[model samples]
Target: MLQIYNTLSRSKQGFKPIEPGKVKMYVCGMTVYDFCHIGHARVMIVFDMVVRWLRTSGYEVLYVRNITDIDDKIINRAIENGEPISVLTNRFIDAMHADSDELGLMHPDQEPRATDYISQMQGMIGTLIENELAYQANDGDVNFAVRLLPRYGQLSDKTLDELNAGERVAVADGKRDPLDFVLWKSAKPEKPAGTLWSSPWGKGRPGWHIECSAMSCDILGEHFDIHGGGADLQFPHHENEIAQSEGALYGKDRKDDDAPFVNYWMHNGHIRVNEEKMSKSLGNFFLIRDVLKSFDPEVLRFFMLKAHYRSPINYSDAQLEEARAGLVRLYTALAQPAPKVLETALDPNNPWAQRFAGAMNDDFNTPEAIAVLFDLASEVNRAQGDEKQLLANLLRSLAATLNFLQREPTEFLQAGAKDQAGLTAELIEERIAARVAAKQAKDFAQADLMRKALLEQGIVLEDKPGGLTEWRRA
Candidate 1:
């Protein structure tokens, strides 16, 4: 049985699917105001590994991550840029998807947008209102009365008074209680917004917290097997979702008398840059695309998993190069040619693979599992002769262990340095071709001078192995 460190339970609980063979999962997605960063990549890759491992263990997973295109940030951005909300959100979403693809994150089975489920959100709010768990304030804003909900502090372990004490209670005279959070916001006359929904209350947009609740319930039912997100959203975000959904969904669909939202709560740790958490305010932040420009996505993925998923990782260039070299070692082991045919079966004597599986079985300990892979790779590199079969087995088994290592050994072995050299070689080849043409024109002085210059510069031309002039650094 697999054990997952559930955030809500605050314990590593044995994972039992709500339904026998299927895993229902929903991961909170990007807000679409800006491009995805390494922080987002950490969550995406972590959960992806979770999903892959679950599938490997013979369970079907249904994953849903939502797109929060409608929110305060999106509205603020749209107004600032003087662009339509759709235009701004669409551009950012495209960039976000591109980053996700580059990072090798699997697309969720269903990626519902918040705008598509306005009616569902309003209906849930209506249910909350009717149940006296929520109310529409005099200002036409739908608010979740956290004080009215039973065990309101269960998820975050924060009392209603504690939350109110921590936060500067905004002087919204419309709300009767300080703990009540917005479910729907009434549009103000001064704000020029692009999206509007017609509701019994008034004209307004769905609150940030309401979108996920509505989207999740519409697709995955009142409850799911797991609800995952970054650790930062544990407070008002996930907390409010639990209260609103339980009050609204469980009441409507009495069959799910237990919980209205999710069975398991998984949150990935933060991404730091040199021991400081990457935040815009701290100026220690990087966009995913910018990071990818300097390093391969696989290397980034590998660096992330080096530490446990729930533990913070402080990234730096040195750490990245270390990961790059480590990945190269694995690929080098894979590249060694094998004997004619080898049995595909696991070697009962191969303790390395067992170690890998053992680590993985222990709550997806990827760092230890990776250590096992590296150990096997070292053994493979040290072996000669009929070790081809061993290398082949490693090539296959490592893929099962690390999804990022799906490339053929030779392809994967090419480091970023080599790719840079290849580009330089291409330019040199163009220079050589131009030089050859110059020589063919019978400009003896230019040819002699060029040939001498080439020899002086360490470009020793000879009958090369591939019948093409190849050059290597001296």
Candidate 2:
């Protein structure tokens, strides 16, 4: 059984879904105003790993990651670029898919876009209003009445008084309370025409918090197995989701018959840059495409899982290089040709497999699980004959759970880094040919010089036994 740390409970707890043998998970996804950054990548990859593990653990998983396509950021970016909102969002949505593909992310079962769920959002807002948990302000904006929900700050572990003292909430125009968040934003005369949707609160769009509440409940019912996002969203975003979702379901007058909104809440830690939070405003954030220019996507993914999901991961060239080397070692073990070992059903009872499961079950402790992989890889390297083949198969089988080490080892090794210093597959091959010619002529000095030159360009050349040489980017 898996024990996940529930953000709401603030402790690790055994995972039990509302339905036996089934899991329905909702994760807050990208707000598509620009290219996804490393932070966004963590969210996508983390949840992907979770879903993979759930299915591997013999449960049917229904994963839904919602896209916030109609947010203020998307609207502003579209206006700035003088394009339609759909045009701006569609471009980034495509970019996001490309990035996810490059990172080897498994697509969620359902990707619900905010624009497509407007009717559901409106209906939920109306329910809140009727329940007196939400009200239309004097300015026509509908806001959640935080004071009415006694457990408003439960998810964040902050009482209303503590939140008020520790953080500053701006008193927006027409809001009854500073802490109250908007459920529906009333349209302004200066706003773009298509940005608004007709609703009981006039022509305006749904607020960010209500979008997830509506979409998750609509798809997964009033309650679900897991709700996850980055730790940054633990405050107002997720806290408000808890308020609205639970408030709508149970109403202001709580009933014993009402079910809890989400059974478990999970959050992955942030990706830091040089020990500081990575952010665009700080000029420290790295775009996924930008990073992929230098490092292999698998290297990036490996770096992410090196640290526990709940722990902060630092991003730097040194860290990525280290991750690259580690990945290369894992691939090197798989490169050796051996007799095919019979594929067998995954046995959790296997000693190494049990260790892997133990680590994974204990709150998805990837670092420890990865250690098990490294240990198995060592056994694969030392053993021979049938024993080695069995170990190799076990290594591959275990790695598949985390979605790693599936590619042919040579393919990964020779794939090299993405375009760097004008190095291309043709250019590297040409250099290799020159080096081979020098060696064939017995011009040892010239051969050594050619090898040195390629090495200087971050390529490592390996001499094989059959007058063959292999090269990979270092």
Candidate 3:
């Protein structure tokens, strides 16, 4: 009984896949012209969380996240770099994968590149034109006839006139209406060969909006369970996707088989910095690799998931430190040794697990679900022996559903912050040995001094029975 906030309907609806126990989801993925920014991190992590939860709920999921390898931005970036479009895009695509791997994102089931699906895009455009839902302009650009589709602005919840009024730019020379968008753009003479594809409408490339429509339809069919992207795409991008996909398949006909393009539309909120919107012009844009230089990748992922996916999250060093501290506490509990734990799947009988499920079922409310994790951590800390092991096992199991707490607790706890170079492992161990010797020799002052010195360097020392000492970065 999972409920998803369907953006198309503007309400949370019970999720029922077109095929029972199977979900076909398509997310608009990165346009690999440049390094991925923090904004891209949110999209990658948020949808990844969704996919993880669906599988944990026992639903088989086929997640398709399309990459826009060919676009206006890609073409321009290649020109700026004085390289072939393939080289420019391939470089960034690899960089994107590296970043995704750092963030621990699962590879999508089908990562269809816009460039590879040129024929599929052309076929959809051809159908749109034949159905009178699109037109070939005088300039040879085939544009979707937004006026022909009555539900043009349904996803955005605006009428055509209202949408047209909000437009800042006047109609272009070849467009029939100001609201009309290109499905196929006529190739420019100066554009590189890599950017152009031969189509029925002459040599050109797929429009940005049409890329998702064709890729999703070709991979997941016309009507799928879920379609998602960032909230900024809700207006022109996703709305155009609806128009293109539905118009091509159903056309402007009567009420015959009124199946929508997608059953659910999900959009995650934006990432802001210091309470202001993140943008390059404002100098707040951060590259994922650059941020990873200072903070651990897990810390970044934790920071991204700390806030509810639909709620805007403000980014700052202070915010990241908070996320790091919270993760540390959980890992600290997990680092403790315990007896064998037998639990595997989430236990319905466990109160904590039930609460976790309820939170996840309610529109994937991660904030509430994460709160349950902290509660489980508390129980794990308070319990003893086998009870402690069971609770700890449950905590890890539940966290796995959210893709948290998968790494070795020691690995995560000892990794320390990338920016911190205060105490090396060798130095920490040497100090621990010195402190142990000092304690053994009854030199109380020297032992206290060794402990204080290590503490000063952000290392916390915990003395155990049988004269064993353990340390972790603070």
The predicted structure with the larger lDDT, 1 or 2, is: 2
Poorly placed runs, candidate 2 (over 4 Å): 165-168, 255-258, 338-345, 420-453
RMSD of each: 5.9, 2.2, 1.7
TM-scores of all models? 0.85, 0.94, 0.96
For residues 1-474, could you state the per-residue lDDT of candidate 1 as single tens digits? 577887777888888888999999999998899988889888889988888877777788998899999887888889999999999989998998899888877888988989989999999888888888877888888888777775676678777666662353354658878777888888887566567888978999888888898889889888789998988887778988888888885543334346547878888889888898888889888888988887888889999998888888888988987888888767666655532333233444667656666677777899988887777777777877677665656655655545756666545543343344344555656766766677668675875676566556544443244534434321
Question: What is the lDDT, from 0 to 100, of the residue 388 in candidate 1?
Answer: 60
Better of 1 and 3 by TM-score: 3
Clashes of each: 0, 0, 0
Q: Local distance difference test, per candidate? A: 0.77, 0.88, 0.88
Top candidate on TM-score is 3
Q: Tens-digit lDDT track for model 3 on 1-474?
A: 899999998999999999999999999999989999999999999999999899988999999998889877888888988999889988998999999998888999989888888888898999888999898889888888888888788898999888962454336668888889888889889888877878887998888988899889998988899999999899899999999988888888725468888999999998898888898789899999999998999899889888989999999999998999999999887877632333347878888989999999999998899899998899888888888987888888888888888778877777778636666788789989988898889998999998988788778899988989888778
Q: Estimate candidate 2's alpha-carbon lDDT, on a 0 to 1 scale.
A: 0.88
Where in model 1 is the C-alpha error above 4 Å?
Answer: 165-171, 250-257, 338-353, 417-474
Cα displacement (Å) at residue 358, model 1: 2.6
